[model samples]
Target: MSLVIGLTGGIASGKSTVVELLKKKNAVVVDADWIARQVVEPGTFAYKRIVREFGTQVVGADRKLDRTQLGRLIFGDESKRRQLNRITHPWIIFYMIRDCVMSVLMGRPFIVLDVPLLFETRRLLWLCTVTVVVVCDRDQQIDRLVRRNHLSREEALQRIDSQMPLQEKAAMAHFVLDNSGSLLALEEQVENLWQQLQCIRKQRLRYYKLFGTICFGILVGIPLCRSIATHL
Candidate 1:
């Protein structure tokens, strides 16, 4: 089995940078954002359900989901957001698990599940060997969002406020990466964390092997003891 790491961060956090570094180290990544888009593609089951729930206005002329328009629709509407999640989350989870299984079959040492809403959903937490959250200060996050998305300050703040707070996420995570400094600093932290995860993986493998050996001995010993008792 592979060490499955659930990776998440608030918008504009440097989670992508860590993911790229992990990729360089040969970690297999299962990205939820990519799967979310795939599940909502033109004729997918989630797509059909979305159209039925949100109507045709959310669809573009190219027969693709106008994600921007749909975002606008659910921006401040809690009920609509839940409705959309109910439609797409199941399919996303299905694809995520499939990819993880394939990675395990191929003998990946570790698997990174890049899920933006990992903490919010908490549905896939059980599958993770560890959970990591990347975070920066609120001001840094807001500034990054403003520059990256070309949004005004107020807009950036609003986007940041929409999701669960970074602090809250960090509190729940098994490990927290503080990305408020230089790229080299963040890279160093990631490397250290990777080493720690590798140690954990080895420990788990050893435990599983020892457990199997004990069970095998118990099974064999029970039959041997029964035969000896019958003869005596």
Candidate 2:
């Protein structure tokens, strides 16, 4: 069985860097953001539901969902944001699970479920053998967001506040990658974590094989033993 690692982080916390390193190490990654976009493509069920709920104004001239307009509408209103989440989260999760299962069936060493809202949804957490959260200082996070996203400091803070607090997520994670230091430092941390995950994956595979063997013995051996007793 492929080990499932749920990777998450707050905005501007350098989670993408960790994911990149994991990819370099040949880990199969099932990204929730990528699945979310696919689920809302023009012809999808999610696209129709989003249009019905948010109106045609959220659709662009190209007849695709206007993500910028939808963001503006939902970000400022908690109720609308929840409504959108309700409409899209299930579909995103369904695809994420399918991809993860496919990766396991392919016999990959391990797979990363890179989700921005892993902690908020909570349900996805159960699907992972381990949860990794990338985090940095709050001020550093805001500064990074302001620079990277080209938003004002206040806007960055608002966007940060819109999600669950970074501290809470870090506390919840089985492994925490601290990104408050330099890029090299973060890279080193990721390398060490990847090694650890490999060990864990090997251990899990052994356990699964042992369990399967025991189950097979119980099913086949019992029937064979009964047949032998009947012959006696």
Whole-model lDDT per candidate: 0.91, 0.91
Give one digit per residue, the lDDT tens place, for model 2 in 1-232.
7789999999999999999999999999999988999999998999999999999999999999988788778877899999999999999999898998899889887799999999999868878999999999999999898888787787777678889998999898989999999999999999899889989988888999999999999999999999999999
Ten-residue stretch with the least lDDT total in model 1: 68-77
Cα lDDT of model 1 by residue, 181-229, tens digit: 9999999999999999999999999999999999999999999999999
Q: What are the TM-scores, per candidate, against the unseen true structure? A: 0.94, 0.92
Q: What is the TM-score of candidate 1? A: 0.94
Q: Which ten residues in a row are the worst by lDDT in model 2? A: 149-158
Candidate 2 error regions (>4 Å): none
Query: What's every prediction's RMSD, in angstroms?
Result: 1.5, 1.7
Off by over 4 Å in 1: none
